[model samples]
Target: MRRLVIVNQKGGVGKTTTTANLAAALVRRGWRVLLIDMDPQAHLSIHFGFDPESNEPTIYDVLTQGTSVTEILRDTEEGLRLLPACVDLAAAEVELAGVDDRHYLLRNALSPVENEFDAILVDCAPSLGLLTLNALCAGFEVIIPLQPHFLALQGLMKLGQTVALVRARLNPMLRIAGVVVVMQDSGTLLSAEVISGLEQILAAHRRSGDAWGDARIFSTRIRRNIKLAECPSHQTSIFTYAPKSNGALDYAALADELFGTAAAAPVAPADAAPPVAAATTRDPRDAEDAAPSESSMRTATA
Candidate 1:
């Protein structure tokens, strides 16, 4: 299975939206997908109509109270399984501070049920706290959701440094999958300039052998779509809310690039092992062909 963490410290860049839609798109292509909401806001849960205040077991229970992932698992109408979160999850960092090897909590909790799904994507909050650290530890591939703007570019260099630190000290197999440009406005000169700036920085990282060496800006730019923002209020994925919308088309194209297609889906064992054991035979895609070429990026996005 592909264990991915969709993360970015910058808010309003579409991390949660990308995670939700990407999982839905993957499921639509015949893969069983699981979503883990590591964010304390529980926005991911609410996107699927899950009640954070319904008194049901949640990811907070699993993190602090030793609840199994299956206990809190909820099925979406669109075939995705979710590990919902709530406001109470915000306290876990403080609660887990005193524990031994706190970083491994998520990696450990996932081993038991990871084999049941073809993909597991974690939605992290807009911080580099303990919660996000746990996600970095558990995930093998990191997918960064970026916005093509000058201010947005500043945070990526810092985020890349954090990922490098974590890879060296926490998870060696961890690598950046790619950057998905969201809320894109292709007609703006600022968008083109920001994308060019991104290319230069990433190329430098590659030459310097940094954490973002294998990363690239995916060509599938999620255009500004009101339906994407609207779907969350209706408690459903964009695919189900507006199948013919730009939001759905963009995310579906992303899913195709990431997992290929139904006939040639991502290659992983049906009954895969845990992160520690599975790291030995890491996915080749994790470290290959993701670096974006300037010409190709422009050809596709322009």
Candidate 2:
């Protein structure tokens, strides 16, 4: 099974939205998908129609109490299964603080059921804390959802550094599958400039034969669509809420681009290696800036 972590330290970049919709799109295409909500906010669970207050056996129990992920997995309308989250998860950081190998806790928790689904998408919190580190170490590929803003690119650099550190010290097989630009407003000149800047950075990385060699910038950008923002309130995916809308189409295209038939050709395990590290060293200030700001969007019911 291929594990993908939807991560971005910067909030408001559509990480949860992308994770929810991508899982939905993959399910619509006949893939068995499991979405693991690693975020303590439980936004993903709520988006999938689960009530956070229900105190159902959630990912919190699965991670801390050694509960089975299968028990927590809830089937959604579109055939997507979600490993629900609860507010109790917020205490995990403090609870698991003294535990040994905290970063590998998630990896160990998920290893048993790794083969149960075709794809496992982890919706990480907007931080490079223990939770995000666990998600990074647990997954084989990282999918960063970026917003086309001046500071978005800066956050990507910091996230890239953290990924590199994880790869170098923990998960040797981890690689960046792609950078997805989400909530993109094509009509804005700033958005256009950000896109061009991303293109140039990607191009330079491609040429450097460094940490970002295999990393790709997805061609299918997720445009800003009201339908996407509205679906979560109704506890539905874009596919079920507005299949013909731009939001649905973009995610479908993204799914196709992620795991297409041509790219399915199997190769020897020995041939797979982590992407080369980027030559760009991360500035410490970048990390501070990439951290979730106080004004970060909270998961609030409308």
Candidate 3:
């Protein structure tokens, strides 16, 4: 199975949205997709209309109690299968702190059923904690959701450092497969400048033949859309809630690119204007501090 972890250390960057819609889009194409929500806030679970408070066993049980993954799995109306999350997962980091194989618990738990699906997408919390580490250890590929803002870009280096550590100490196969730009306000010069700066950085890294050589900024950018933000509250994906909307169109294009499938529909042009370099400047220290702490990470989301 193609295991991909959707993560961004800084929150509110459309990490959960990317995970949910990408899984839904892949399932629509007849791929068996399994979504695992590692976020303690349970937003992804609630996005699918499942109450995290319900008595169902969550990924928390699988990690802490060693419960079999198949036992807690649920099928959604959107043709996607989910291994849900709950607010109780917030205690997992503390619970796992004493375990010898703490970082690999998720990887071991998923071994029995990894072959059942064609693709598995893991939705992570907004912190670089034990939970996110488990996810990085379990998956070979990562998709980072980024907002076009100076503060968001500042956390990229920290995330890159963490991924590098995981690759060296845990999963050598792990690699950043793609960088997705989301919640872009096309009218803002700040947004445009941020995107330009990111492109230049990626280009420089590629030229230097660094680890980022294989990572490309996705051609399909998720434009700011009310409908996309509304779908989660309505408990459905963009494809089902507003298939004709621009939000749906962008995600469809993203899915096509991710799956290496022929584009069934032409990608929409980016709505953004040219960037103003001055508007994109920020203090790097302030940007680094924007990442959530473990105490506050549970509430982080897109």
Q: Which model scores highest in TM-score?
A: 1
Per-candidate Cα lDDT values, in order, are 0.81, 0.78, 0.80
Task: Give the alpha carbon lDDT tens digit for every residue of 1-302 in model 2.
Answer: 77999998876679999999888766655567889899888899999899989968998898789898778878887678888888888788888899899899888987777777788999998788888888999999999888876666776677778888898899988988889988776566767887888888778778554456688889888877678889999899987887666677778778778876313423313433221122123233322213233344233211
User: On TM-score, who's better, 2 or 3?
Assistant: 3
Could you tell which candidate, 2 or 3, scores higher by lDDT?
Answer: 3
Minimum summed lDDT over a 10-residue window in model 1 is located at 273-282
Q: lDDT by residue for model 1 over 1-302, one digit each (tens)? A: 79899989977778899999999887766678999999988999999889999989998888888899889999988778999999989999899999888888888888899888889999999888889999999998999988776676777777888889999999998988788888776467778888888888888777566678778888777776678889999888887887766677778778867877555654434552211111112233432213333332221110
Candidates ranked, most accurate by lDDT first: 1, 3, 2
User: What is the lDDT, from 0 to 100, of the residue 81 in candidate 3?
Assistant: 86
Q: Between the candidate structures 1 and 2, which one is better when assessed by lDDT?
A: 1
Q: What residue pairs are clashing in model 2?
A: 210-276, 210-277, 211-276, 211-277, 211-278
Better of 1 and 2 by TM-score: 1
Worst 10 residues of 3 by lDDT: 272-281
TM-score of each: 0.86, 0.84, 0.85
lDDT of 3 by residue, 237-263 (tens): 988887766667778778877775532
